[model samples]
Target chain A: MNGPSIQKPEIEFTDNIRDRNRYGRLWVYIFRFSTIIGIIALATLLFNIINQSSGYVVYEAKGDPAALTLDGVPIEEQTKDQLMRVLSSHLSKGAYSKLDRTKPFAERSRNDVYDLVVERIVKYEVVDSWLLWDSLTRKDEITAAVEEEYPEALLRFDVWINSDFLRRPQSSNPVIAGVRTAVLGSLWTIGITILFAFPLGVMAAIYLTEYAGDSWANRIIQTNINNLAGVPSIIYGILGLAIFVRALEPLTSGTLFGVTDPTSANGRTILSAGLTLGLLVLPLIIINAQEAIRAVPNSLRHAGYGLGATKWQTVWSHVLPNAIPGILTGTILAISRAIGETAPLVVIGASTVIYFDPEGPFSKFTTLPIQIYQWTSRPQDEFRFLAAAAILVLLALLLTLNAVAVLLRNRYSRRY
Target chain B: MEQIALGYPKSRNGLKRRFRVGENAILALLFISGVFSIFTTIGIVYELGKEALLFFRTPNVDLWSFLSGTQWQPHIDKFGILPLFTSTLITSLFAMLIAAPLGMGAAIYLSEYASEKVRGFLKPILEILAGIPTIVYGYFALTFMTPLLRTIFGRDVVEIYNTASAGLVMGILILPMIASMAEDALSAVPNALREAAYGLGGTKLEVALKVVVPAAISGIAAAFIVGISRAIGETMIVAVAAGAGPNFTFNPFKGAETMTGHIVRISGGDLSYDSIDYNSIFAIGLMLFFVTLTLNLISQQVVRRFREVYE
Candidate 1:
């Protein structure tokens, strides 16, 4: 009963829709392909790092540890006194004296002396190395290559990350190098960052959301904070270099407290780095905390007022308790950012090769990122391996902190 | 609660006064905290300006030559910034080429095409990409990307330390930023438009492209701008993989220096605090700061405009 004109229009429309659907499917596949690239990139990054961190190495000691052994006692098995003598006797008198002056060998443990002997005396130099995948899949090929490359060098599988990697301090030699000093410095700086940024950020957010009037001044402050968050971190480094390092050197270097080293002090201390990082993260915390505070229902505030509670009292008792979890969430993110940050610390003159742990707020410091950067820039392939291991440690620390934050956020969300 | 309120008598006016004083003190403290951000900005400008001004004040230095010249040999004392500026642009362009399309497409997929379950599973994975430190990415660029690139482009074509490797890794680093921001914009678009397109027999892709993308264009543009800013400011990747030699060439296969790379290289070396070379980095930093700041402000304005339209 339908007219030919109506049927013809319907058929044409159907054809057009079909053609569009085919093209749509093609575009959908392309979009999916783009998203897959991100996942692939992550996988590639992990694979590349893990591959470098472990492998086969053909190492040749310049002066073999066995030659230093008295009565066949290997260097690693030597007692503290014996190891000390071995290290001292092997080293040139001036070098030994310099080592002693740097840190007394007498006070160091047997393990430390043994490490020193291995590093200074034994001097294990990697002649050749292979990545983990090659070591595993092309085992015969690697063995042949090593043999062809150096018959004298010992061939063995090695995991770059071990207990020694965590315990030992920075060394010029990659075999003895570790992240101990850097880890301590990172912890100290992050500790200061949280102390400085957390309370101030939360307080500012509380004041703006709970107490402040809708005045132009308050509005300006709010906008300033938002802009600050977008500022490049290196600019903060410039500020830290200027204000904390130069202008406020007396305070940051602890000279104002009369406890700092007068000769070496230039305000390029952990205190300066931490305070700069604090500034870097302040806006982040304030923004996040503001969001948290704003999420609190107005009804709750009204209930407090109806109960004759003062504005401060209501915010303190009811609002703060409810908002604590959210504030913590923001703080966790800020701490993570500060911990991973390298540019500002570098700009503020954090020593890339610092061997000493941060002694106090005023002490010079280096962080995990700085350590990794320093190692990666070196021409040695072995330092790259060390950098990879340090990266794993850094990732573990960041992930644990972030996991806690996520858990808290989820728990609070579920409860409310 | 009622009994506690009643228990406060007129004789407890002293306690009330103490409480009021505490409140005022705390408010003042908060006000001080709020002003700290403003102080930081001022400190940055002042420090950068002071040294940058010192750089220009050097008797032999001509401002025009410094800005327009091509050579950046601090050893030779030639501080033309054109090479650095051009390298930065070339690297940033490569980064944009990789980031813009992939990030936008990923954002579209996450917001429009992906199911709820897929989006939930993928978002955190993308976030993990963001959480990775830049130093690590730098290493990946140096060791992995460089060799891989050399093999593909041939040994003669790709240098060991080239802009391509750094730019590629930087693109990966900023991909999460672009995707997340663009996804936010896409999600903000009302679903009613999508439903209307579907009712007219429009497919998912058609609806996403024709209906959602146009609606979210400003937001997507903001995401790309922010990505550019991030790429420009990134230090470790460029500093490590992009060679410190400031070259004016546009070839991605060759090594070149970026502004951040230049700053890091100079600062990391043994430069005296008062040296003209050290002060030169401050001038470079000033340029970087303004460029990034302007981009960020523009991005914010774009987002605001998008909000006005959609809301």
Candidate 2:
């Protein structure tokens, strides 16, 4: 019927091409600007952290180092015996014996003795500190302020993230405090988290992708996993507090194994923290593993089946090996999330001031994020600098993990 | 074949029988693993519910009062949750005000306008933004954003620990989340729709804004909802930047504690077990869990509806 209306209507084009193009260009710029905003935010965050991590500090020593010099030798050039003698004479009798009791001077290295002399006798206390930006641009102002405010204090530019900071454990005094214990705790917690979450996540993914077959139960399981992935991480901490820390205290505290330390008999151990993190990351791992498994072409499975293979055999021999790299990439990314996660760990009661390193799964622990959180909360400005330094360490760790994941995904991802 | 195949077939059948048992066993193991996620959900509900029940049962705390109360001082036994709830709402809304438009714009650009090279370069940057820890974001809020806010708005107008800084930094934290999700949704819109619009002589902006965006609206809505839920549930940022006490104030510059912030602050302290302080955090956690869960379910429903339209 429409064939009868063959005549074309008068072609009229709207004369707003210029306006449309202008708006289009403006919109594109807006979109581009949004992305630039994110980059700017990231750069500012990094810049801020780096700015705080190294700065000039005005420190006052409790006693003059020149007073302890032996036969006109400066404290720095003194021999190990001389340093020990200086420490012994300057330190109280109780303090001297306690230091020797903890670790005998004979067993201690010469540098260790010298450090003790400096820490105990010299006792450098930071009177004031300036951030890198101010330390650079307002150098004269800071110098003048420090001289007027702290006449006897020494002014020096200190990099907060030094080897000594990394080597020492946490202390109440910000001058000597370090993230050594927190770093060890993070490693231990993450090690246990991987051990707990990886295999279970992969197997669940295999089941959902292969064997579940769209059953109602499987659908519920799938939905549950998605919902769990969205659950606030702190809720997992509550669960850990209830389940791992309280209800299963015997297991988490190593009481059941008869290896409990009286001081650490509570369930706030690395094991509980790790398990909590594992649960928190489980949904992430499963979702990612499922994606990896689904990416394995169906042809691989069919080929295995054509060769008279069982379902598990096909999945194990063909699907898993093909999906391994993708799975690992996803898992590593999830693990990095766990590594940075502080909420649940805080809820699960990560120790904020633990000085000793985590000895095992049963030991009380504090993670790097916890250290950063605690340090940032302190009213003192120096603690903020310490937190920034810890943040840099954490960022370096997470970036390394992300880089490895990206490399693995790029290197081994199969085209099919 | 006629002479020796008899013994081979018998052994093969026996081996198959044994393999069947192993297969069933492995399947059972995998099934349990899949069920573990369900158990986790149950565990969360059970733990939160159990403690929350105890909290409600306390003579000092009634459900009605807890829901309607304004002050949340646990030491004085004031357990009203409105202060924390409103603070959370205010921060989340503030964050969404920033994240929603920016995220949608980035998504539209990446999906509709960006060249492949641009998308590739921009995507990793967003990923890095997402990968940065929230604690770092919290630090940024406290150290950089707060001071900047004070400078712009004036120190007298802005508290040192205020919701404005927390919400602003939180927007940055969740921007990548919304952008990537919305980008996926926009990218998923059948190209035929864009072509149809273009054939009708729609400009690039018109095609994106009127045709593609409306088509992907549900997915974008879901992304927005998820972003809000993330902002609500974000603990470290609010805890570190938001004030310690619960204050029912609508002003973004005023100090107030979110539910999450309260939980973190109280629980971070050395609370004895079975104390009202300890139990109250769980109650707050329970409320947080449900709010986030409801938001998540709604987003899932929206996403599912969107998937149905396309698939």
lDDT of 2 by residue, B121-180 (tens): 999999999999999999999999999999999999999999989999999998999999
Q: Indicate the residue-level lDDT of A229 in model 1.
A: 85
Clash count for candidate 1 is 0
TM-score of each: 0.94, 0.94
lDDT tens digits, residues A1-416, model 1?
56555434444433576777899899999899999899999999999999999999989989876799876787767789888788777889999999898889877888888888888878889888888998999999889988887987889898998888999888888888889999999999999998999988998898778766677777788888888888878878877877898889899999899875733647888899999999999999999999889888888888887898876788899889888888899889888988999888888888877776678998888899999999898888898999999998899899999999999998986244
Local accuracy of candidate 1 as per-residue lDDT tens digits, B93-124: 88898899999999999998899999888899
Docking class of 1: acceptable
Error of 2 at B172 (Å): 0.5
Off-target runs (Cα >4 Å) in candidate 2 are: A1-14, A100-111, A144-151, B1-19, B306-308
lDDT of 2 at A99: 91
